[model samples]
Target: MADERATTVAGNDAEDLSFALSCLAAGAITPEELKGWIQLALEQSRELPARVFELFAPGLANALVPGWRGLIGTWPGTSLSAAEGRAVAGIAHARFPELQPGGAGAPDRAAASAALRESPAIRDRFARVFPSIRVPDEGEAGVGCADAAESGAGAEPDPAPIWWLAGAEDSPLAPANAQRIFDDRRTAGDLTTMLESDAGSTLVLVTNRARVMIMLTGLGGESGHATDPLADGLSGGFLLDNGQEDEYRDRDTVALPRALAVIDHILTHSAPPAQGWSVEVEG
Candidate 1:
């Protein structure tokens, strides 16, 4: 039954991808439209990365299109071996030629790994998303002096951090609606309140990636004052503070860690906030 269900899902995804590609080729669909469809396709199938590589291998040039990079760059590392991951990265490098050494995309693995290890912001984000990766020595970097003193004095070790991926698409919610949600004074206040309530809460708003808007949710839900997850008509999911397994669902939920890694890599290698997104960190 599982195999049959998987086959059906794969078939549906293929049809969706084909339709989107045809629409794109015919100029009947905009790049944003095609991107949304691609995201939806990715959300439905875990086999998508390999399938995409196989399908686009014959015409590697198709991956060069801007709309395709988000899918290609954010391909799950678990889905591909190291060699396969590098191969996909190589294709992305070809597409953006700027990713070559000394080009805009030139941050080597060493630098990125080091940033992941040392940068307070990156480390904090990683701790929230992958609690298992957090060790005692390095994890304390983000702790406040008072908190550290308290821990040293007698308090129990802090609880693990919770991380969530918040996302909005142009389909379910239009751009104007998005702007309104972000712009609303009440919503802004609510977000502020959430951040203030939890010292570990962090929010990263992604605006410029096609028609996608993504944010990170950290530990900040007080009693009787939880932030509405669907305020922006966006969907979300989280990596539990206690490090529970996640049944990958939508792109935002499944791709949270990879998305953050991509964002970090881009920020480390590329220029300023030209990608039409801004990140806000609290705590």
Candidate 2:
């Protein structure tokens, strides 16, 4: 079963790579654009995309060199669009010309839904890591915190936990802040301590316009001011920061779920070791 899951993940990666390549070939995306996607994939699982390519498609792996290195640095831009999603699927189909047809070229909504059906491993891992947030599906309406508050007028409201790093000052987890978090060992250690101290606390980080709620399960005992803390046991998603208005006009609906999946993957597969800490999304 483990082997089967590995194979399935590899196949899914191939589809993703093929889709990326297809998008590149179709002139719908540039290499830089593809790199952004690869970066997001890496954040989800350090071993992936590269590992998938190295194991199954070594030739393509070599092709993605230095540009793929970008994944190690800072967070890139937003998630792909529905049209881009279709292009990714299309490219996957094109790569494996021998695969069955009809489901290859277009983005299948069912596939997205199926992917959301959490696997037992993912569910168990999430349960162990931290409390889970019930995020609304894309395009759902009136589910924001304000709406929830209004609806529960007569009852004691059950608000979700909102954790933030001290001195974060409600700043968005933009590229600059992410870089700082990655670079400052003192800050990283402090954050790690905070995460370790609170099991249910969700550390809120922000991108330029999105809010990333991260939950950390463990921060290994290594004491030195290392460069990247929270290396493992980090998973997050983009959701409306509760009570904050939609501040960014150009919002990408897909970013949060994608970020969440990446965090979950890191927690499940690359948990921090007991003696030494490891950072998953350093670059």
Candidate 3:
């Protein structure tokens, strides 16, 4: 059953790639635009995409070199659009002209992967062989424009047991807490300390978008509770509630587009005390 799940994930990833690529080939977005969406999707989906990509990464490596590596980086701290990300998917098509969604390849997949890994010269040759793809010099091609701050302080945030909230409204997690977060946003090293400190506190990290990340831990370890209630309510979409139950839904979901909208609103409505956080905007 686990294997089945893995197979399904891989197929879905291919479909996702196909869709992303089709969007790119249609000229709907520039490479820069695609990078942002790809970044978001990868974070939200976690390791799912990479597992699926194994089905075709070798074939696509020639055309996807720079883009694949760049896309990997965006998942953590950058934004990438789906359309632009299709360039990475197109790499597979470039490598194996006969390969397509639901297509068959070599009899022993592991052997092929082993062969590729064993030969550095063959790998280098493969990259150079594809002239039409235009692999750019690392220094020349750039990522996207948006600049995002690192998630935690150079250290860490006070991870002591506490309450956490989602959204940037004037709820329990209000301007004061927001200010605290902003104050601590100076360096990642500081933030790391906070996350590791408290075993029983609730930590809320808000994105410029309305989305939020919540961490719950306890002295004994961590609280494992029913998150389905919150997920069901928020999954289909629910009103922003300060209700006690809404306090911790275990894990929650916030769509990127909506999250961005929330972030924009926050930026427009309130300015972080300039003294607290370091600001960097990428052009």
Among all candidates shown, the one with the greatest TM-score: 2
Better of 1 and 3 by lDDT: 1
Clash counts for the predictions, in order: 0, 14, 46
For model 1, the superposed segments whose C-alpha errors exceed 4 Å read: 1-13, 49-283
lDDT of 1 by residue, 45-145 (tens): 66554544433232443444444535444322132233332332322222232232334543443343233344444233223322212222223322232
User: What does candidate 3's lDDT look like per residue over 179-259, in tens digits?
Assistant: 345335523322211222213332333322333332223423332211112223332222222321223222343333222
Q: Lowest-lDDT window of 10 residues in candidate 2?
A: 1-10
Top model number, lDDT:
2
- Give candidate 1's root-mean-square deviation (CA, Å): 19.4
Candidate 3 TM-score, C-alpha based:
0.23
lDDT of 3 at 146: 7
Q: Model-by-model lDDT, in order?
A: 0.31, 0.32, 0.29
User: Candidate 3: where are CA atoms >4 Å away?
Assistant: 1-9, 30-33, 43-210, 213-283
Winner of 1 and 2 under TM-score:
2
* Superior candidate under lDDT, 1 versus 2: 2
Question: Looking at candidate 2, what is the lDDT of residue 272?
Answer: 25
Listed in order, each prediction's TM-score against the native is 0.22, 0.26, 0.23
